[model samples]
Target: EPEVTQTPSHQVTQMGQEVILRCVPISNHLYFYWYRQILGQKVEFLVSFYNNEISEKSEIFDDQFSVERPDGSNFTLKIRSTKLEDSAMYFCANRLRLATDTQYFGPGTRLTVL
Candidate 1:
């Protein structure tokens, strides 16, 4: 069995700095997504990407945020400028195929903005 992977399990950064979170989804999954959970808060959807374009996005994915699939196996999320409020655990998820909606989630990349 295969699973999603995220790099730099933990990250610490100063406010106004940029951060890029990386993810690798399951080998055959077609739908990819990014979600975030602030400490003590509920998990929130950030954006969804398919076929190299965005399929859906939440308000949280504003001008400061961007996502890209730089290669066939890797997906990335970039935050242009970090804020204290941006501190949270970011997760990556992917669905096996278009026939099903089931998504497998990655452990997560924790971002701490000071």
Candidate 2:
């Protein structure tokens, strides 16, 4: 079966640099989302995109963050300016629909900022 794949399972970056986390969602899904977990915190939704525009975004998705479908299969999240608090496990997920649908998450990209 197809699955979501994330790159650089762990990443360490400076407090003012940029980082791009990559993901490949399930091949046949139409909806995509990004969520983050700060250590022991709950998974917080960042944004959800479909049909090439943002469907929903949480307060946590500030100007510093952006996402894109660079190609047919690759989805990427870019943080323009990182902060120490930005460190977390970024998970990429996708599902066919929202009503009664379950998201399939990637292994997660752990970002560490110092």
Candidate 3:
């Protein structure tokens, strides 16, 4: 089955450096989203992208955070000046364009900021 792909399944970064997380959503899906799960916590929506632009984003996705779909394939999320609190499992998901479609989640990428 076709599924979203996330690279660097685990990333370790310094507190003040920038980190870019990458994903390739299911090709047939029309909407892409990013979500974060703090260890043992509920998953929180980060941002949603469609038509090559941001459709929605949470308060947590501030100026320091950005998303892009470079080359019309891979979707990327960049976090500038990582903070300890930013360490979490980030998941990439996609949903079909159909009105009642369900979102399929990709294997999460674990981010650890030291």
Residue-wise lDDT of candidate 3 within 2-100, one digit each (tens)?
A: 888898899999999999999988886778899999999999999999999999999999999999988788888999899999999999898989868
- Which residue pairs in model 2 clash with each other? none
lDDT, candidate 1, residue 59?
96
Candidate 1's displacement at residue 54, Å, is 0.5
- Give per-residue lDDT, candidate 2, residue 50: 90
Put down candidate 2 lDDT per residue, 1-114, tens digits, no spaces. Answer: 788999989999999999999999998788899999999999999999897788999999999999999886788899999999999999999997656788899999999999
TM-score of each: 0.96, 0.95, 0.96
Give the true-structure RMSD of model 1.
Answer: 0.9
Report lDDT per candidate.
0.94, 0.93, 0.93
* Angstrom error at residue 32, model 2: 0.2
For model 1, the stretches where C-alpha displacement exceeds 4 angstroms are none
How many clashing pairs in candidate 3?
0
Clashes of each: 0, 0, 0
Error of 3 at 5 (Å): 1.3
Candidate 1: worst-modelled 10 consecutive residues by lDDT:
94-103
RMSD to the true structure for each prediction, in A, is 0.9, 1.1, 0.8
